[model samples]
Each structure stands twice: as structure tokens, then as C-alpha cells.
Target: MEQELFTAQDLEELQRRGISLEEATQQVEDIRQGFPYLEILASASLEDGIISNEPSQEERYMSLWERYLERKDASVYKMVPASGAASRMFKMLFSFLDADYSEPRTEAERRFFDELHHFAFYELLNEACLRNHWKSIPKLLAQGDYKAVVETLLLPKGLGYGSKPKGLLLFHRYDKVERTALEEHFVEGALYARDSLGQVHLHFTISPEHQRDFESLVARVKDCYEEHYSVRYLVSFSQQEPATDTLALTPEGGLFRREDGSLLFRPGGHGSLIRNLNALDADIVFIKNIDNVVLDLYKGPTVMYKKYLGGVLVAIRDQVFGYLRQLDKGKVSHSQLEEMSAFMRDAFGIRLPEVLDDESLAPWLREKLNRPIRVCGMVRNEGEPGGGPFVIRETDGSSSLQILESSQINMADEGQRQFFEAGQYFNPVDLVCSLRDWQGKPFDLERYVNPKTAFIAHKSQVGRELLALERPGLWNGAMHDWNTAFVEVPLETFNPVKEVNDLLRPEHQA
Candidate 1:
């Protein structure tokens, strides 16, 4: 009977992972009941949840951010999610690696080989091929040994790029050198995240296996970037907590077990990085994906918009903190309370239910004001695959801004489907977040997570199909209960290298 759920060793393993018995029980229950579809009230637009500032307002916010950066005590840091292997980026190449045909077959495969030398990593891959196989790429092509070239780039005997993280892969070409996605992030951090102390702090969530490689890469380039930009670098790294790993379930919704009768667990997705973000002591935390960095020529707009978003955050935080202090001192008037409510509605996209009671207003304002605030940059929807910002009505009859994924929505519903399709803006995961309260205390970010927002995904391991659980996404349910704002940003500020071909785009080619 005990073995039906957990054995003694299983219990010990759960404890070691920091997962409580109650949490495990709840996860099993979730697999059984399934997560509820998010109710979409409407898609966030320029006239809805999104804020599109005028040229003058944009300038003012940029100036405010510059002034805020000049404050001696201000702290800002950039957080990048860079954990996963780059296996997906090499999906086509992997197919070629296993195919019966030795030469390139498909158009994609042909393009890869035809333009192989155009890649920033061309020289490196060529050198790896020669070093590992005693034949250069040109010689291999002359011999019609295309697989040899790919194997040299991907296999352990050579560059081993197929198993490497995207952050370490060469992405952009400069006149003097090639840069990885990680190095580009350092440049961007120096441009915008540097404080009055001339220090740029950055944290990356990376796979434990690649931590040393990432550290070495940073060590190799940190000094050069620091000297080039005249700024000090404070870099840090973290791995996903084993405790946040979710159990894999069988098709029958039972606990999945390996051949050794041990349970299978998978990483809990980017949402788990909330724990890493929570651990930072920064006042302003900028969250961006590791693969979203662009070439130096295209960084100006991205840097400007980053500062603009941060400026908006500081300006809003100042007003909210002042109102919270007034509420703390019991000096707030009825008119001031109304003004606060208006600010929440207009600035935060929070539509509260009608409340006439004066006593209840102070605590309510304090509760809302004391939470974390994030200004997410939304771009014009160009059919990119990511969560789109939406305004959803909560259980309390209030409505708040949220980033909802397709899996979370009931696409079967005509109205919800229409709203989803009608969305004009897209979430770029471009966020400028404030994690401190008015009293200068760090918020317990876990408290704001919406547990019901976890995802159930179908996956296969070793030819066995299973249902994997993913925690609420970092920008979606993890920050669900926080005050949210969406500001319109340029499309140029949102180039993400989702595919290897994307690197060939003009933005990355310099």
C-alpha cells in the first residue's frame, strides 16, 4: 500500500529536492484535475491594457530613468534565462546527422551547407573539423563529406555545439571579432544597467553542466567589455533548484517511474527562475531571454527603450511609495484615496471593484502598493510564438493585466478565440521589474504566484510518452498577483534568435 504512492526512499528523495509531501500530493492532484483555462476578458491593446506613450512623454520617461540611474544608492541588475541546451537550434542538422543521405537533401539542409562559411562560427567550426578529423571543411566538401563537417561542429570530438547552450554559441559578427549571445548581453548591460558607481550587474540562470563554461566565457571577455565601456562588471549565475522539478506522469495519470522503479522529474520551466530572481538584492531587475541579444548596430533603440521602461517604473514607484507612506501615517484624505484608485486603474491597468468604504481603502491601497511592479514592453504582434498580454477579470470582480499563452486559453470558445486572435501586442519578455516595497524591503515573490496557472505538457522520454508539469511561467502566473503595466516598444528592440537561420538576419549580421 505504501508503494502505491511513495516508498521510504521516494520520501527521502522528495525531502532532498525541497519538495514537501503536501506539495507532491498537490501535484498528483493537479495531474488528475488538470489546470483550468484562463478566462480572457479581452486582449491588451493600445487603448486597453497597453500603454503607448507620446514622443514627449517618452523623452520625459527616458530622462527620469537617466536621473534615477544617477542616484548613488540605486541598484539595477539584468536576469537572463540561459539554462537549456541548444539541441533545438540544431534540429535540422540533427536530422542530417541521422539521415541515410550523406549529402544535403532538403532546401534548409542545402542552405546550411551552402552558407556554412557565412556563419560567425565558420572559422571555429572549420578549425574544429581539421583538428578532430585531420581535414578542413573545404577538403571535406571537396570529398562530398558533408556529414563529416556537421559532425565536427556537433560531436564531442570537435566543437560539440549540438549539446552546448545558445549563450555560448557564436551569434553575431563584428569587424574585429565574433560575439556570443552572452557577450552581447554584457555590452547591453553596460549601456543601460550601469549604475552611478559605474558597475553593471548581471545574473544568468544556466545549466549546472555549463556553469564552468559560462564562467570561463565571462572571465575571458569581462575585462575587455569593462575596459571598452568604462564600467565594472558584477556577474553571477544560478541553476534551477531541484526542488522545483515537477514529477512526470504516465498516460494513465499515474506517477511515472523509470526502469529502476525511481520517479522521473523534469525542470519546472522559466517560472522556477522566480526563485533565482527573488534571491537578488537589486532594486531594479531587467529580465530578458538569453537569445534575444542583437548586433551592436541595432542596440541603440533597444538600449533607449530599456531606459524608457525603467524610467516609467521609477516614476510610478515614487508616486506609489509616497501614497503608501501617507497611508501609513494615516494622513490620506478621501480625495487622495480616489486619486490612488485612479492611478491603479490608469497606470497599472488594474480595474478594481467599486468600494465606497473609507476604512477599507487604506489597507487595500497598501496591499496593492506594497507588491512588486513590472513594466513589460509589448511589441506589435507579428505572429511570434509567445504569451500575449491580456486583461482578465479576477475572482474578486477586479480585472488585472496578464500575459496568457495559447495553452492557457480555451481556443474552442469562439469569443476567447476571437479575442486571442485580435490581440495587437505581443509580450517580448522585455521587463523592467521593481522587487522592493515602499519600506525598502524585498518582497517574497513566491507569495504572488498563481499556483493554478501551472501547465501540463505532453512529452516523451526514452520512447515512453508522459505528461510533464511546468510551473506557472515567470512572466505569466509567477508574477500574476503583482501590479502589471504594458508599454509599447519598437519591433527593432525585440529581435530573438529562435532559429539558427535567424542569426543570418541583417540585425545580427552587422
Candidate 2:
């Protein structure tokens, strides 16, 4: 009776995870009550929220960013979400292992086997095959033992890539060496995110299980990259806190439990990385996905555009900071307030609900300008599957630019679906974010998160159906209240390796 719904053991587990029993119980209640769909105003396009810069403006913005870097006043860091396992990349091959036939049956299977030699991991996998079956990949294939080669490549007897993170998997090939996705991030950080002090700080949000592997890989390769790039690299890692783990629901819509009778929790998705990002001691932080790396030949556009986005933020951030400071003086004229309002609308796509007196406007200016800001890279939709930029009406009656995923939108509403279909740009998770406010104080990022943006997902555990909650997405709900800006980036700058075969794409190949 004292514990009520939970046993004393359950309370102990909650304490171990830094989660309160009330929070845990409320999670179950929230899952049952469900999160409401966002109120949509319209899609963010070049005509409104998104900034479509001209080709000639590129030099100006890039130069502005270069000057910001040379100023050496603000520090920059890069945050990558790399904890995801590479199992999904090999989903097709996993099916092959269980199929009735030994030989390639599907077109994807044939393509994978045909292009196997072109993969960066080919030679290493071949060595693994030899060690496991006493035969090379070619010999194994000739002998009609494709599964054996796959087992050697995937299982512990070989590279163990099946259990490894994408960051550790070899993704690109060179004349003399191969580089993993993590290594590519090092190169990219040096190219764009480096500060004038010749330092580049990168933080990876990874799984605890993979920490030792990451450390070993970094120790073996960090020095070489630092020497080659002529810059010191400060690499760090953090596991998603167990406190951020959300409770899962059983198929029947009750609190889910494991076979051993312990409560079940799942990672709160990338949104949980916000806590990790908040811990960075940087003024500017670049966020990108781990699987978005490309060969050096294709990195020029990415590097250049990254600078351009940073420059855009630098210019806007300077203006916002200046306004915030001016408002602190409390003597801004009506004309000055009008200009501030115009800039807010033009630069940030924020519109106040109604007119206010100068006394009220000053505080409004300070409130709006003093917040975390992110310049997200939006690309032509090209019919990609991901969140897109939109202008959503806020609770305060103002409309702010946002990136909404399908799960966040109410597609059943015709008007909302029309707005959804109207969006032409896609969020590539390429962002240059300002982490500190005008007074040089870090923002308590959690204060800006829109909890209503959290998502419910269907999942399975040991043959039982379950529901998992993905905290408001990192780019979507987590940053919902931040000052948002969208910039168009090139389609070429958006290559992602969703599948293992995607490595065969020209962007991934050298």
C-alpha cells in the first residue's frame, strides 16, 4: 500500500536511473493520454521563414564567418549523435542469413555481393572470412557459402560490425588508407568548426557499451589526424542519461515489463542528446548526423556551406546581442523598437500578436532576443523522408518557424496536410547553433523545450508489442522555443548512408 502501483524494488530502480517514481508513473499516464498534434499555421518557404541566399551572397557570408573565426572570441564545438548501431544498415543482409536459399535471391542481395569488393571493409572482411572459414571471400563465394562470408564479416569471429556503431565502420576509401565515419567528422571539424586558437572540440553522444571501442579507435587515429590537419582535436563522449529513458507501454496500453518482471525503458531518441549538448562549454555548436559523411572530393560544398550558415548565425547573433544590450539601457526610441520588430520578423520569422507601447515593447525585445538560436540547413525536399520547415502558431499568438516530423503533424486534417505537402525544404540535421546568450551565460536548454512535441512510437520486445516515447526530437520539439532560422543548403551536401548499399553512392566512394 505504501508503494501503491510500484513495488519498493521499482522505486529503487527509479532512484538508480535518477528518475522519480512520480515521473515514471506519469510517463505511463502521458503515454495513455497521448500528446496532442501541433497547431500548424503554414509551411516555411523562401517567401516567409526560410532564407534562400543568392549565389553572389555566398562570398559575403563565408567571409563574415571567416572573420568571426579570426576574431577568436567565440568558441565552437561539434556534436554528433553516433550511438546508433549499424545493424539497420545491414537489414537486407540479415534477412539473407535466415532465408531458405544460400545464394543471392533479391536484387539488393545480388548488388551487395557484386559490389562487395568496392566496400572499404572488403579487405578486412576478407581477412575475417579467412580466419573463420579458412577461406577468402572469393573462395567462400565460389564454394557457394555466402552466409559463411557474411557471418565472418558480421559476427565476433570477424569484424564484429553487426554490433558496432556506424562511427566505427569503415565508410570511405583512399589510396593508402581507409576512414571511418567518425574519422571523417574529425576532418570536417578541422575544415569548418575549428576556432582561431587552432582547436577543434567534438562531442559524441554514444552508447556506454561502445565507449571502450570509441576510445581505442580514437587513441589509434587521433594523433595522425591532428598532425595531418595541423590542429589539436578535443574529442569527448557521453552516454544518453538513463534519466531520459522513457517508459514503454504494453500492446494492451499498460506499463510494460520485461520477462524478469523489471520495468522496461527505451532511449528517448536523439532528443535526449539535448542534455549532452547543453553541457558543452562552447558559444557555437555544430550538430550533424554520423552517417552523413562523404569522400573528401565531395566535402567542399559541405564545408563551404557550413561556413555560410555559421556566418549567417554570426551576423544575426551580433545584431540580436546588440539589440538586447540596447534594450537593457531602457531608452530605445519607438523607431528603434519598430526596427527590432521588423528584424525579428524578417530574420527569425517571429511575429508578435499585437502592437504594444514602447515600455512593453522593450521587454518584449529583450525576451525574444535573449534566447538560444539555431541556423538549420534546409535542402530541397526531393521527396525525402524527414521533417520539413514550417511556421507554427505559438501559444502566445505569434507564429515561429519550426521543423515538424510526420508524427508531429495531424495529417488527417486536410488543411494541415495541405500545409505539410506545401513544404519544399527538408531538414538535413545540419545546424550551427548559438548556445549562449548576450551576457555570455549558457542557456538552460531544457527551459526552451516543448514537451508537447514528444512522439509515441510502436516497438517490440521479445515478441511482445510495446509503445516507446521519443522525446521531442533534437531539431524539432527540443529546440522549439529557440530562435529558429532556416538556410537552403545544396542537395549534394545532404548525402546520408541509410543503407549499407548507400555506401556505393558516389558521395561515399572515393
* Cα lDDT computed for each candidate against the true fold: 0.90, 0.90
lDDT of 2 by residue, 361-393 (tens): 789778988999999999999997899999988
Q: What CA RMSD would you report for each candidate?
A: 1.4, 1.4
TM-score of model number 1: 0.97
Pairs of residues clashing in candidate 2: none
TM of each candidate vs. truth: 0.97, 0.97
Q: What would you estimate as the lDDT of candidate 2?
A: 0.90
Alpha-carbon error at 216 in model 2, in Å?
0.8
Task: Return the lDDT, model 1, position 140.
Answer: 94
